[model samples]
Target: MIGCRHRLRMDAAHGRELRDVVEDSGVRQRREAAAAHRASVRDTLIAAAPDAWVVIDPELRAGARAEATVRACEAGAQWIWGALLPQEPDTGRRGGSEILMRDTDRGGYIPIIVVNHKVTDPRRPGPADFHPLTSELSRWNPQPDKSRKLRQQPRDQQRLAHLYRMLQRHGLASPSLLGGVIGLQADRILVHDIAGVLDDYDRRYADRIAVVRGQSPTTPAKVPECRQCPWWTRGAEGASCEQWLTERHHVSLVAPGSRAEVLRGHGVTTIEELAAWTGEAPQDWQHGPFDEAVVTARAWLAGAPLVRRFETVRVQRADVEVDVDLESYQEHGAYLWGTLLDGRYRPFLTWDPLPTTDEGRSFGEFWTWLMSVRAAARAAGKTFAAYCYSRTAEDKWLYESAERFAGMPGVPTVEQVREFVDGPEWVDMFQAVTEQFICPNGKGLKKVAPVAGFSWRDPEAGGEASMSWYRLAVGYDGPPDLGQRTRLLEYNEDDVRATLALREWMSPRQPTAHSAVEQVPSLADFALDPRATPARTPAPVTASGGGTLST
Candidate 1:
């Protein structure tokens, strides 16, 4: 019989509408409908029999009393039926099994069944998969006495043991019919005996709740809850009190970790206090004096010396250079690859994805042009190099395009692409920066670009933001916003220019110390081809504007 399942909040009006639809459909198939209705009516009549069954919908506040009533019935209620509810607020705990266990002392045997209508996927298993009928029941015999006693164990343990027995009864079962009647779908089932784990979790949860409510003075040894805890705002305005104490006072960075306890033991609480305490290093402390010194310097200095081990800032002079940056949609593939050759910015764009003539077509065209430029440089006895901020995306896409279109005429072979990536012809400024210095701010192109006096025209432009623009450009959700494409191109241009700026800053010709204003030589001054057009010279602004250099 088909049961009309709905939420507890569903009003009588909605129920009437559903009943009308069912009745109208049932009338169309008269004989079959009558049989189905009879079965449903009979089931309802049997369920209504005095103390035969107790049904509860635990999602509603009223369900608590329903559950209490079911518990009060003791052995009289032979069946406990429940509708799966949303988990408890904030705690994420499910109340179905917990409600059933309300009367632990008055335990007899009640076959519990929970209906979960939220599961729509046919492949997914239902409650029957987890708690199958016993083998004795399958053989048309009564359940054993031992099996009845097993139900008195903890809910998790009882369910797990039942599943284990069912599995054993079926002899390493298949997804089809396990016994004469029941089936087990292997792909969509998960069962675990987690009674001990649940007990531990419950104990810990109680302890944490006690700490949060200030009923206990002692904090829990773990503070993973700090991120989501409402009490996180208790300390400072801008930063958490915990963070402020940790940073300023050399306290252990990780809450509840032994380092903070160690520091407190030694009375080296604040940074100033720690600095003064030149006592023998605590054997338990993870960091040494050298690490402390580095942190102290960073805290005090506006521009601390670069961490040399991580830095490799040296100049590699090239006769002809092209600062290259690629812009691509991860799903749709690379669309725009911008190249700054001798200050002139050029972009190869693909707006469509027609096979053999889209992103692939654009890559092929760009590769051919690049090859020609390199060939010209080689013939002139000059070295040509393509520089990108990072090798990850651009290098990956170049190799991918090469491999994808290996047989296509004019596209580079995989071996050639590999050579270009591995050789000196392709330079990654990210590697250059990493080899030269450790940046506390970050190693991202945006982070390091500012150090080299580089900035984007559009503040919102970023790798992820560009992908969002690409989505709009391709009309993925709605009509394409062409303006987004222009903004994306501008962002890409800024990226390539940032790499050029970094290269200039790292040049050995520049002063060693950070300068308020360093003259940056124009790419035109080092152009290999006299015929190539120079970039348009903008009106001279401050050094930050990144205009053409006089020097």
Candidate 2:
């Protein structure tokens, strides 16, 4: 219910899922592991509670929900594990909770879900304070001040709202309208005021129900959600959203989200129309500058994925440059630091599963090596810079590893990380790309690097796939998979190499060369046709593949 609306509509229509050789085994493993963790935590949480009516039936047999309801009504047992709440079909809400506890009033039960991600940072201030041992949820009282502010996990809030509404329908909900979630740290249950998010959940659910009932058309719009959606590129039974967008040269092919919709309202539906647009801005235009949008559309049509924003394009380069890439498993410590300097690909990695003691040791070694390289460059009086595709992920671990392993030898201090990140010595290639060029096709390393003639050795070199490989490599449950470990190392190495390739391509080490902008086609070069070339011969068939055209 909380997923993509298009996916929901398709599911309601019994749409066939994409049957491609998808790499979902790792995703499956992650889900399974999370479920296992949730189950283990739930068991531990309710173990000390008195007579917790544990529902073990996975199928929720004929009388399971009934029995659970009867037990919940008793109110004697404060904790109920694996609760199968009664379904409210009219409201389109039905689900089970990992743990349901008696509300503060004890008049009804409130839902508690166990999730894989962290719900709150103890270091930060939040809305509620919960005690796991007693399962008590105390609302924030500024007088005493004990809160770990809400951690932007809207799905959990929506889910709690869903369960709360279900409880209300059954006459077993408190007026307080609250719920709880036990995150990765099982010691704490981050309770929430479900009342705050109920309206949002209601609005979303009502709209999704309309979509499911075919009352709303699931028109595919090019957005962030489309990346993981199966209906992208192609669907199981129809021409995909990709095909539809391409055929019309949809403005969204370049401009994302509501920008394209707003453009359409201005009679600019296709990329060609947007490129040709020379009119003044609408009275209340809030979308970005008209000039930039037109330039992007022109870039898209000309197949120049990136267009220079100015006459001159430059990237920060140094005599001694190191391309860096860091890999981590979903919120678990960063396990690998891959660096490409000169021509060598050196990797600092831990073979053990992440969140292990060895992670600190590995990180310490990597930090020491990196600093040594910088120190050597300074000693030689040669300028130095370390480059990463994006600094956000790398910057996070750099500071966290320091804080996480404060006393560990060789671990860089938070101040050191801050200095490096803030200084010009640490260059972000993605930021450079953003500053120097407008990328119509999007600026992801995988998307932009290929334009710079960089390709990964592994076809499936992505964060998602790496997670599964990490699990197998570390032997999460069984013997170590050496092949997977090798794959991970290779992937990490290639990532660093890709960044290096992008760096050299953007700002060549050679004294004189055509910059990225000078090397690619410009709008004038595509006067006849966006894709046309002077040396190109026309294709034998028609655009629709109906018949051969006379050359």
Candidate 3:
């Protein structure tokens, strides 16, 4: 009891023991960390080693076997060894090794490396030495005391050797030749005249070449030229026109026989000729046939400026006012309709349903609203305009309901209306539309109005809750009798508002204050001509297994 009254204290002996425990624990932790780090380093080193080649017991004359031999040579392998089995049963108990030599097309005797137990020596054999010559082999061999062989590499690496061999056998053995092959592989150009291309590059880039003597374009000395010419075309005064031929440009010159024959056949000999030939211009010369390509190439070489056609002009942001159109979607099974600016429904002017249709009435309404809204906004003296997001909300909801209504059977009789109103289907549909299109994940008209800087307060009803006109009118579907007339008008009005809003948003974001609209034509229309020539399609191919798909 007397000893317990005082706090316990460790003596020097006890203190030494406690310190020893802590030191030992720390030492254990450090050892584990060091071991882990060493393991990681060892794994990385092993993984970085190149794969080993596995030769067959008996070598084949052609295919992958031949390809691997060539690749090993190109990859800087110094020797080729073949594996052989010991004719004497006591030589190793497992197998033996040997080197192979074969005839090459270049008049030299090339060695083929194989790893097997049996071999018929190409040369008079004497010693049990000699193996494949390779940097990896040198590094791993020379120490006969080592028992294991190098790890075998994957078959894909061997196949890669085959691909390179195929390319080398073909016309692509040099860099210029290689670039042409690459260009063709990338679909950028044709690989014609590979040898000429290589020779051309060799002659041009072989020495120090001066391009221009001075800065002024007035003198031939001022404008420099390239040392190497890929096209091998030359001009007078020690200048080459090859670069001009290759560089892309818009204007094109054609020998009337070459150019006129192609265009006149297609009925586009001149601009007025083109106009009379086809009311609408061609899609684009980029998408044209080889004749157009030749013309374009010639034009660039001759330094002709591109001709501008008014029909190709784009509408600029500053020169003209913008308008937006928005219309609500009204679906009715096979047929769908809308009433522009009103929340009513119409029967005949509606869109078709899916499976038989591309897009819903909603998309069509959006397009119509865009066309009209753009025109109207211009009239209202607004260059950029937008329709509020509320219109999208309304249209989306209506589409969902109309889809549900269409899927139901028979006609909408008196009892059917009551049932439609009270059934689980109606309740679920209503809830889904509310949750998905109306709430937090989505926007109600009231919320987006403020985001777009519209400060107008909405009207509310009842003590239960307050709501805006946009919210209440949303998805009302209108009276069935009116054929969606009111719905269309309401929808379109919203579209116009939203389009106006978008334009306002875009105006401030422009990089410069420059008016883009100044360059556009007021109202240019080009009609499609029936007399235009059609392009020919390539013939389809069918194989024994199946016909291949084409774009």
lDDT of candidates 1 onward, in order: 0.50, 0.74, 0.29
What residue pairs are clashing in model 1?
A: 249-270, 311-435, 311-436, 311-437, 312-435, 312-436, 313-436
Total clashes in model 1, counting residue pairs 3 or more apart in sequence or in different chains: 7
Q: Please give the range of 10 consecutive residues that has the lowest summed lDDT in model 3.
A: 1-10
Q: Which of 1 and 3 is the better model by lDDT?
A: 1
Which scores greater on TM-score, model 2 or model 3? 2
Once fitted onto the true fold, the runs of candidate 1 whose alpha carbons sit more than 4 angstroms away are 1-313, 353-357, 508-551
Model 1 superposed RMSD (Cα): 18.4
Model 2 agreement with the true structure over 1-551: per-residue lDDT tens digits:
46667777876785545444474665576688698788778566556553545554566684676566556556555666777777666866778777776654546777788899877654445444542221333222212225444457888888899888887877777676867787886766676778878889889989998998899987666877777666776564477778977888878888877787688788877887877776576555576676677777766655556666655567888989999999998777899999999989999889888779898998999999999999999999999999998899999899889999988989988888889899989999999988877777788888777766777888999888898888889999799999998999999888888888777776777736545436544434333443322232222212112332232
**Top model number, lDDT:** 2
RMSD of each candidate relative to the true structure: 18.4, 5.9, 31.1
TM-score (C-alpha, index-matched) for candidate 2: 0.84
